[model samples]
Target chain A: MKRLLLFVPSLLLAAFAFGQKAYLEDPDNFDPTQPTKILVDIKQCDCQRLLGAPEVFLWTWEPAELPASDPNNNGSWTSSNPALAMTNEGDDVWSFTFTPTDFYGVGADAVYSTGFSFLVKAKDGSGLGGGGCDEDKTENLSIKPELPEVPVLVVAGFPSNLLPQDVFTLVYDNSQEEKVSMQNLSADEVYCYASAFVDSVEYEVTPFFQVPNNAALQMQSSGDGTFTLMFIPEQFFTNVPTGSTITSMRFVVRKKVYLGTADQVDDPLLVPVGCP
Target chain B: MKITLKYFFILLMAAPLFTACVEDDTPDIGEEGSKLDGINATWRLVEVNQQDDVSFTLETRNISDFLLADGNAPQITFNSADKTYSVDAKGKLNFWGTEGSWTFDDDVAPTNITLSPTGESDILVNLTATIRPVDKFLQIEFSRDCGGTSIITYLYKYERAN
Candidate 1:
């Protein structure tokens, strides 16, 4: 009677376990056109067979259409999506990083209506999708360019270098002024200031120029996004004696320009003013 | 969500793990007295080499003695970024005087720097000082051809300010 009582409870427990169906936790909305989409998810409903399983394996296919029917076999898998299989991360969550090309991007011109899909199985031979009933899809479809590259600021023309003369003669109209233009410069955020070296101290020569609202900047009509700053030193000296020779000078575009030469992008050209 | 809990537990375990590994091994990128940054600082006269009528040799004296103990500290502040250099010179070093524009020769590497008066006060002459940036200081060699072989070579040693 004691043995029968234990056996009856075991039979009832076995009957209750057979009703739990295995299924994949699929993403509700998935677009197949993003350049790069990475996901880490996927849990099995009935994972009792995979108990203590060290890792799980995933079979993925990309740039390929969804299979017509549910696949119950494992031999029909390819590694087109860069990853042939993925081990379970934890909590049944898996990792999937799609190739930038597999998605239907605007630049691709080729439409891949159906994105990549993959099936999962435990390394211990346990079926992932409802015990082999469904497949999982990724999210996001972007038709845009792969990704924008970082912009680089290019400085051209002058921090107009070269010391032409010893005395900075205020020619009736021509004073030694440097014209420095920047390419691909976003002037809205980057404020430019002119810097000159007199003795050993670096003075903000930006005030000497007739700039836009005390901001030394003037954008050119070159559609290529170029900005220029004219640094003319009329009252270039402050509290100094007369007939002072101007030494080297350069232009910098950044916030808090005087926070020292560090963390600032300065034009490489130097104005070597000559003594006439 | 299960994911949030997993990451939270992971962050908990990782919090202490990473705390012990927190060590900033970044290289010191301070470029003191190199390139243009070399001359960008207040130059205080620290040492001097007084030139006599003898050979190219001159008398050596710290700035304390060169200024005749006058406490009227003679200093040529090269605020180069503003294109202005102020000078409060006294005694034999009367030429620097007040303010001026200090320039350096660039055709070659900048070893020659010229100090020209900026304000109405005209400098006796356009003083061109030779600059040599040592590891932590800028050594300016100013020479005046008083007459013939009686050239005065004033070696002005300057220490950099922060």
Candidate 2:
């Protein structure tokens, strides 16, 4: 009996050393006294036996004592936000990219620590299964244990502008992560951006900052009271004009609304001039 | 000693429970719900009998010589003032109004359609049709014996194009 107790400590020590980092932390270790923002990559781990697509439910909690923690775990953590969790195409892998809502020191004056753990559930409630279609029940059905540490950080500044267009593109050392796309551009707004996606499937919506045309523009109304976007191309163009400055041949000149979902065009309007 | 033996026996019995945890977690596959019912809307005749068959009368000469056309040039415009026009859900192209007495037998193969005129049967055509959203063209034929025993067929095709 004494030897068994002696072996338990060594077994625990070995387990702790080999275990993966299962908590959230600010990777940059920013000050928690100010508003801190960190982008988390909640990726799918390969530990699941079935084709498991991981969906996360995030919360802030006080860490419970080990072994005494609730087993059929009810909500112990305070919920923050919910978002659509997507998966990597080739595998059963999925990920959630999110930042905490009140990263700024909204609740306190001093640095504090709290537990943030995501309760992950399989998209299909049937947990990972054994090999083959014939098996009824084989393996012990228990939550596969994994944990991620949540690090608190101090926020440095308010957004210089609260406009929805303000965005930060994180270019990492290798730049392997997916780039988010900017969306819903309006008329007369100009933007410039250079970006590439981590995966080809996500390339369609990669976001970026807008660059406006150099020449200031104004709306010039026609006799029919329909206005056209007018720009003095001479000031903006450094190269010879290959295309007409007057948008007569292009979509901007006609101001056509192609219909589908507002995002895509199914059948374009074909009204003749002054038809409407 | 007796208690330890019982615990060992329990663990041994439970070993089978933990041996192969494979459960068929596959989701149930069901047939996709019935293909959305084909919509009934005004369709124009594209060809009276066969496409590009000029033997079909009322074929226009202005179009491509190979293309067969219609004579009446009938265009179905929704009477914007009519209360039924606003209630159409199939979009302006394929929808009908509230008070629509429309029924279609698209469930049967090679569906047949009939139009029942509202209030006045001869002057205006109100339809309950089995037309698919595809096949935007409809042909209506009327045969009459004219000029002393000569049977003349009036063939007209309406094509759907805005």
| Each model's iRMS | 27.0, 35.2
**lDDT of each residue in A1-276, candidate 1, tens digit only:** 999999999999867543322211222322333424333344333323443445545443433433434331233432222233554557645544444344222212222322334444443332344334332322212222222232332543321122322112110100111233222334353345555666665666446223335533433223334434432343433423456655655554443223444423444434544321
Q: What tier of docking accuracy does candidate 2 attain?
A: incorrect
lDDT of 2 by residue, A89-175 (tens): 334323334322233212221123232333333333234334322221112211112222433211111111111111111111111
Candidate 1 Cα misplacement greater than 4 A, ranges: A1-276, B1-34, B56-63, B66-72, B90-92, B119-135, B147-150
| Per-residue C-alpha lDDT of model 2 across residues B1-162, encoded as one tens digit per residue | 999999999999999888668686889765332212323344333443211111112221212111222233333322212312112212111111223232223434323222233442222222223234454554444332223221222344555454
Q: By summed lDDT, which 10 consecutive residues of candidate 1 chain A come out lowest?
A: A166-175
What are the TM-scores, per candidate, against the unseen true structure?
0.26, 0.17
For candidate 2 chain A, the 10 contiguous residues with the lowest summed lDDT are A154-163
**DockQ of structure 2:** 0.01
DockQ of candidate 1 against the true complex: 0.01
Q: Tell me the spans in candidate 2 whose CA falls farther than 4 Å from its real position.
A: A1-26, A31-95, A101-111, A124-276, B1-162
Which candidate should be chosen as best, given lDDT against the real structure?
Answer: 1
